[model samples]
Target: MRLIAAGLLLFGTLAPTLAIPPPTKPPCCPRHEVFTECGSSCPATCNSILERNANRVCPDICVRGCVCREGFVRNRDGKCIPPDRCGRDGHRPGDSSEEESGIRCHRPNEVFSECGSACPETCDSIVKGGSERKICTKNCVIGCTCREGYVRNADGECVLPEECPRHESSEESTKCAPNEVFSECGTACPDTCANLDDPKPRPCTRNCVIGCICQEGFVRNDEGQCVLPSQCPNSDAIASSSLLLAPLPECGPNELYNECGSACPETCDTFNGLVENRACILLCVPGCFCKDGFVRSKDGQCIPPSECPKPTGSTPTIEIITPECAINEVYSQCGSACPATCETISGRSPPRVCPAVCISGCVCRAGYVRNAAGKCVPPYECESNPECGPQEVYRECGSACPPTCRNVLNPNLEIACIDKCVAGCFCRDGLVRHHNGKCVSPKQCRIPIGIFTVGSSEELNAE
Candidate 1:
């Protein structure tokens, strides 16, 4: 009886241990995989179609542990995929296949390849017939290449080498002088010594022109020769050289000879406000100009400015009126180019660096900025606007890269933040923006699935 009681007590203690099943081992099979006691010896894979077509055989056997689900095969990445996607080619959809047997090249006499030459012979290269050898890169590229005895044409089609179009040589029937080169497309406004010292900007036709152009660092001279800029004759030398031809004609009173005179000469009729804003061609005109304090008469004679004719109409006294301005605005002869607006009233924006030129307009008064309604308002009024949400403050200049729930937990993440400020509502201090565009405390921030917590709240808050 004593042995039976001891045995019963021992069995009772062991029964509880046996009743609790062993902690189930975590599943080792990844996604798209299942544990199997008996798996196919030769399961379908990315290369199954090619292998089957080659009459490859599969031995009757079992593969235990894990296998892909039905109708799915393992790709090169060991991920199960559909049978139709087996032996798929490029990294993107609709791309040409790299498989030798399944490739469907678009152009004739072309074949697809997994590894081909980076630089292939083209029709243009063959037509040019240069003795220089092409330096091809060794990097492998997956694309279509022309078959033997064929080359890629300009139209991106593979054609026989003899079918390339012939181009006329630009140098044929054309001769280039020293320091000049023949170009199929040259600039219409070739640099010349006459215009080299001119400060005005000139417009030229944007067209492909065939002609001879001066070589680099050289310009054309008046004698039609390409020479270095230092070799060009100066103004005094040119004037002395021209003296050999003929003496300049004598000028009238208050007149002088000008190699390049103003096209819009000041005349008696236009001395006043008659032609104040007239547009004239900015070109050099060789003629005589009036001396200082003199104007040209209609008879082409220079006279004193005081001798110019006056208008016969009666003069009326005109009153200068100041423009009426809205509230909080004042009329000024000069206004800020970078005007203060609701978007720039926070004083957090960069300092305004406006040009010294005056801009006549109605400008906001001191400590005021224009609002969305085009009315000048105080900075405090902007802060009181209802555009800001709860726990968010409106800023004229706010951080472009604001803290969000996606990056709040991982503040050390590298983000391309612009240095400039943006106008928007931003989260207040000790708060972060949520994915739903609401502001909340860091502790209340919900971490994304892939991101895990690293430390306690105090450590994160301190950071």
Candidate 2:
């Protein structure tokens, strides 16, 4: 009881002191928001911007430690250096011991032998002529400096010399129409339409920089004359509208509208259900193409569909048959109604394969597969390997034969099964024979284009 009373007395004595919590650790310095903490330094050259923002908390240790400011990087001595000096060693820019100089400055990439003048506070002191503005220097030091991709203009501004207005030395007049200019070197032509979607990375034709070039709103015509955008016959209605004139017929992102006088015939008018061709747009002039299974011949003609070689690997060969039904009508067997397109499948019962020898519902669109539900689904949604038994391993699920005959996982099979279904596994590596049938290597399995029966003797013998 006496000890309990003594403990109570001690607690009462220290309660007031304990109640006073230690000072809350201040929040990190606000300037630290922009600066990264590199590490400790012996002679710190940075100043604390923490006082400027009341909400900032100082770091527990190294409260005044060195930090790299925005656009500046930290050096070995924990000094904040300009971006140029980030990887450089032992190169302090403004460490001169010269006398104080009066204010005068050079823009970026400009330098003198010494600190001949203090850095200018503003750009107004240097800007001189047409469309040019002054840009103040980031550093005050002067030395033998190399400015890349830029030259000091007469206006005392460091600017890119390329594409700048060039002075013509020849007395001959090379005047162009409004919105056009004469250049010593010009490019052939630019595809104005291609640049509509993305302005960056616009194509460059030598006609502009090499010789006389039309300005942004103008294009050169057949007579080699710079004319209004409307005069450029190649500019289609949609392109013209995009350029802000009249609206015209619109094509898919891949398709291009060709005018009457354009080069290639427009065959894409008929909907074939495929992406437009890239080569067709280039060679055929006014055509919307880069058709599938077709390549542009050296003579600038699209190779006929029948002449194209088969695509290698497991890519399915689509059998396209003209149906007896009206144009755009889905094809089906002679008696049964053609399976509906996937677009209509949800509204009807599961569809069956159109008759093989005869017309069938329109061939499923590319990248689609018939699922176990008898519904059309994207290939990616098809069930994975399903036929493999307990001993077999499941690899990829698809509508073709796996490489191995006796699936490492499904040993019960008498013949290799290559059905489009939930997939089954092939024999494990180095296994010579399967428990039930011939041992086939994964590489030996070949899924040809078009249709084939699953577990057929022909397919097994071919293997």
Candidate 3:
């Protein structure tokens, strides 16, 4: 009981001295509308802007640490005043209590925020170009840089079209024209048709070894390749084999079959002689005598055409001088002084005839004709193709461009595929073949052809 009495006395005496002023509203917002004074009933019309916002008890009804009153906001007496006297309300852009702040949430490469004062629709954020974005939308025909998971459509703006699915390759929409392809990454060409079966290596496919659209060994080079072994750049190992074998053979082409099979025996050894395995070759057998310009050796060898001297009318003196005469003695092309009747050489031989020297004969490579010079050369058109002048008399092989037409790029160009001459025909681009004498280069076009000019779209298509 004595302690209670002392506590009552202490409360009574110190209550007056400790009396504190009623709470006021924080300066961030107008006190009349949102903040309420302690112990005061929040007025129903504290601020006309917010009516029902004031009806609750003071201190707990509105914004924390704020004070509110009737018509006159919490004035100097911590009470309401006339409505006209109230200052501005609500938070500005960067108020500490403001929920939405200066930061703007935008999509990648978007310029919703603001570049200086204008809206950059086509900002390229990654490259830091103008607005840091490129416009991608139907409205913008110039096209725009698209954000992730999207691509630019024909409309020119960034939009998600079903045709271009996510994570799919761009080849579906990007294409090149024939004789063309994407120059760089992301570019498109209409002609993607590449040769699929090149048995030999070429440059375009980047030294591809197998399964290319353009032939097996060939590839689409930056410059394109249509020729033979030359397709591969110089020192291109694909041109030759490791054992010094000739280039790979493409058989039945232009009816020229040199080195046709796998690997034919290069030497004239009897054991390795195989007619089926022979390449483009024509050989003189061991028993048959060479026509001319061939020599017989003491060891029974047929000297090559290159090694033999010119064929003279008479027999060689070396065989019949002291050497025993045989019905099949090796005869060579060493005779010029003796008569053509297998006569003897005056200085060295008795009246004996000459024989063959080649136990093993010689053969010629493919692609050459047996001329009077007895040398091989590219197949000639002869009288069959008068169009093939001296400049390009060699006939196109049956395997390359067909007998129809062949158009070769200039040799000086980095990329050139087929040679200029065809098997037996030729023509220029965009020309139709009819009963004309022959298709010609633009130099021989028959018509003074050209498009007629028109003033408008309707006028052009109609006529």
Candidate 4:
């Protein structure tokens, strides 16, 4: 429903003749006041997707201007937003600390990712020093060498991995950078919260949440509050938390909690349970859990068993997350070892053996050339390294394994074929070398690296 104001003012500040029209069949009623002026009629002048997009976002229309709708958000152009987020926080959405702050955020967040994505909106400084923050990415596969103030952890979280235990020997003072957050942890700031007025700094201090502290001299009063102007030497200290000093951006126009000053929910599950991570959950209330053998989660509420059962079928598909992939690790069950391989990251579970097993609906891992049996097999040999090298002997001829392989990919495995099997070329052509067996065009067979012998000089006759 395009808006038609109730108890509102403004005889006609807006001129619909120039205003953007609402969508076709916009939901009747329940539409807010901001969109009221947007007119219920469709605008024949614009594209239909624009009409639909505008209506889809009409929920974010602020009665005032083009702000976001209550509980919803808008972008710079005043478009509707995603749950508890802006476009991109520029931080790994998976990082733990980034999430906790999301909890303390304003909206349910589970429904608003397009608004509150990044933080601080500004930083004291973003310095680039020695590579102490090892960024584990495709660009730096071997092992990232991070810069100062950042350390690479096992799971590859570039954090303050190790802190030189406070030297009891010397009670010297540690200086904080100009505006850099410095605590016992490290110098890197918090979610760089888009909300900056939060005078007391809270970074990934304790565990992962934002740990707030009173300014230098002031201590927390009993009310769990810190009276700034009266308590601190400087008046500008507590001026933050105030709307005037730190106005929550009018960015999200109609959003209910846009500037409400509270964190949002992290993740949700319709069934098993909203994770303990951000206290972000909402299921079947106190009455809902899963109905027995069936399971329900935020994503799937009450999934019946046998809908797609069988874990060993040629194209097996399970009801939910499979058993293998239950353990915390990465790249466990693709046919051959490679950087990327899974159809889905089943969170934590036992590895799914390929060729004979799959999570039912999940796609086959990469590097595996599906066999006639439909089981996933390595692109090369399907046997252990011992068959190709030494300790690789005990290696099983199956997919999925514990994360303990010292070196991945057997170097002695069958080589990449340019055209067809080389032996086939030799046997059919009287043992003469035929780059490839497939009697095809010469351009198809690429030259092999490091394999051309000195005496084998024979070029196809040309003009």
Candidate 5:
């Protein structure tokens, strides 16, 4: 009875300790920062306007960090500041005052501008006479450019059209070979001996191309030499020569000799299925083809469609032989052109647009992706997203624009985000990513203290 009483006393002493849960670790962050697991890969900064206007592509990913509180953007010094004060101190490019002070037009007939034309007229462009279309970017470019009627010369100086140095005409310098001639624009497809008698009008581009071609009344021969039509070998002579050289193969019954035959000829086995969907090459094959209303049989004999053997049942049982695939993979006759690989699955570099084309092969099944070793596996099994940080979980298709401390307070920043999902680590609900790389509640985010300045007086003086 004494021993039993002692055991009961020990049990009561340890009961409370065992029932207690582990203490949660508080997030560590600097002043005015809060932890978050799902932060914008492309966070809004003082240069966000410039980057967005410049058409910079932002990576689709969720980053973990301690970001600034709402109604703020990161400045050059990594401090949160108001959006209105982004370019007030002249750090931004193309600033009016900065352009005026930094660039000086020393050359004659030159002027400076904050937003200059991207495609400025040059001596070379003037010489081309607008033959080629110039693709210009619709953005502000700060630089010194030639004045109104002047153009930039090869020596990098602005000059009048008449004052620019002249060169010999390209047509005068070009010397055509024996049967070739120079032309400002030439036919893309030239006539040859094979197509000389063909009545079909070949499709060609209307664009002008300058190059040498056979003289008028001549065509390229088999040896690639320009020859007149009278000098070309006659069909009878060529046929006789070929017969003397080698005898032609005897065609089977109902088959005829054809120089150009359909590569995907109708067969007894494929007449009901593959023949309808198969893609045939434009190039023709040289062989004997079966007569109309007949198809090649399994025994290499041509037979009528009605004479072909029919299925025994009303519903034919097509035995589809599925290919053996690796783990988490499935065979598909028309698979996606862009399959989910390790890089795409991890959102390292996902395709912006996938072509609508069919590719036959073994591919990863739904909810699975291919790994680095080329084996299909579940998305969670991928090595890239397996090491998610605290309070974060791996997602195959998370939001491209996740809520961060910078947008958590406002929640309606007029930033355009791609309407696509990305694979990455995302924070749990009610937690926001802080600038210092931690996940914490939104209320824990601290508001920045004191007024923000661009730079110190000493630094400005040094500059």
Candidate 6:
């Protein structure tokens, strides 16, 4: 009678839908690929499936109706006992948890995403020279490759693909002239080379054909061959021979780096955080910069120093040991007054310094505005207002502002507001802030947009 009851329990657990007799060994049941499919008969005490046992070595049999779930075995007294509760002395030699079996690789970026011997095979395939890391994606596909921004070189060291110089014997070498060298596969190499300080030196092209370019201090001659810098008429070598230096043209008002220094002069390092990669110390073709936030006026006049934008928490605080300015160039300061240069050129009111700490810089040209790309483009060229991010639009000096962000200073105010101007990007009228710090439309927004007061139009026009 006891034997019959135990057999009935096993049968019910395996096939509650069917009333067939319990088999001697578990059958190859349909696999539960998802956790939701693995249902529990008694969810309160025992789990329906052992997550560890959900792999290939274990059969995809059900333990739903009466028997205990996987990671558990029936005791002599007919009670389900966890693997830990089972005495080690009573346990058989082969009986062990999946984790104890030592088949899984617990390395970072590597996971056992699926049930199969295939994962083990993939792990084994990782020979010394092969992929250093292997990851199982969410879809259970094994992604074996080098880390981000790194490619395996011929020596098998995970180095930058660009830093690995191409030799004449390489496949890319045949595409270039005998005098030219293969720079990269589908990249834009510099047309003229100088020892300019490049923060990011990489290929700019996106073709698979590979690029052939001249080396540094060299230029492509009319014969399509690389020649020495001096040989090229337009090379404009700053240093003549060993000692003499070429005189730089005097820069007009509000310019920086119009002349050459002994080495690359450090400029734009401070503005990197406020404006992404806007300034750089260059060795070749140095000129005056309008700073990151400032743009030259259309009439070739500079904006007053006081009218520049302010730096924010996002702005990096880098200290340059020697802050050098070019001839007629103004040293950048926190609150330097702007020159009335634009007023004389455009006959408009002198622009005030952009509000915020360390926001001062050169003014933009008339009829043109600086876009996110940092290019001085016509006002109409700005298709949409500057996007602080997705779902955020620029709020002009007089435009309606969002309520949540009220009384808060915006980091990216377009036009300086002394009395009447409103500035910076804001969430759209119908949009609101989401929990993730992103502005979202009505559907995804947790804080729904509602009635809110904005700055009065009359007050805005009063300025």
Candidate whose TM-score is highest:
5
* lDDT for each residue of candidate 1 in 1-463, tens digit (9 for 90 to 100): 3443554555553322111112123247878888753455455656655455324433333333478888777665667778787656543422323432233577779887645666778887887675334556564444578998889899888889889987556566457899998786787678787877665645343355566889987889877889876677864544423433557777888999885677678888678555546545444566678987889987888998788777658543445487999999999866765788876554334335444344568999998989879999986686554466555677666665566666656642334344565666777665666544555555545433212222333433442
As for lDDT, the candidate ahead, 2 or 4, is 2
What residue runs in model 3 are displaced by over 4 Å at the alpha carbon?
1-156, 160-215, 220-222, 226-229, 233-238, 241-463
Report the Cα lDDT for residue 163, model 2: 28
**Residue 56, model 5: Cα distance from true site in angstroms:** 29
Candidate 4's displacement at residue 317, Å, is 17
How many residue pairs in model 6 have overlapping backbones? Answer: 24
Q: Roughly what TM-score does model 4 have, to 2 decimal places?
A: 0.17
Model 6, 300-379: lDDT tens digits are: 44454344445556755556453553333344433223332322122122224332223234434545554555554555
Per-candidate TM equals 0.25, 0.18, 0.15, 0.17, 0.32, 0.21
CA RMSD, predictions in order: 30.9, 31.3, 40.8, 33.7, 23.3, 24.8
Give lDDT tens digits, candidate 2, residues 134-210.
Answer: 34333223232324455445455666665244554454556566667666545534434333333333223213244
Q: After superposition, how far is residue 434 of candidate 4 from its true place, in Å?
A: 39
* Cα lDDT of model 4 by residue, 408-434, tens digit: 122111111122211100111111112
Model 6: per-residue Cα lDDT at residue 8: 49
Alpha-carbon local distance difference test for all models: 0.63, 0.38, 0.29, 0.27, 0.62, 0.38
Worst 10 residues of 3 by lDDT: 340-349
For model 3, residues 1-463, the per-residue Cα lDDT tens digits are 3443444455553323221112222345354544321222223222322333332223221112343444444322334456555334452222321111112334343222111211222212222223222333222111123454443444445544444334322565434334333322221111111322234322221121211133322244434432233343542544423313444444231122332221222232322221123222222112233223433333444454355344346533433244332332333323222222201111111223423222222232333333334343334422233342211222333212211111212211111123333243322222212222233222223222211121232332231
Give lDDT for model 6.
0.38
Better-scoring candidate (lDDT), 3 or 6: 6
Worst 10 residues of 6 by lDDT: 16-25
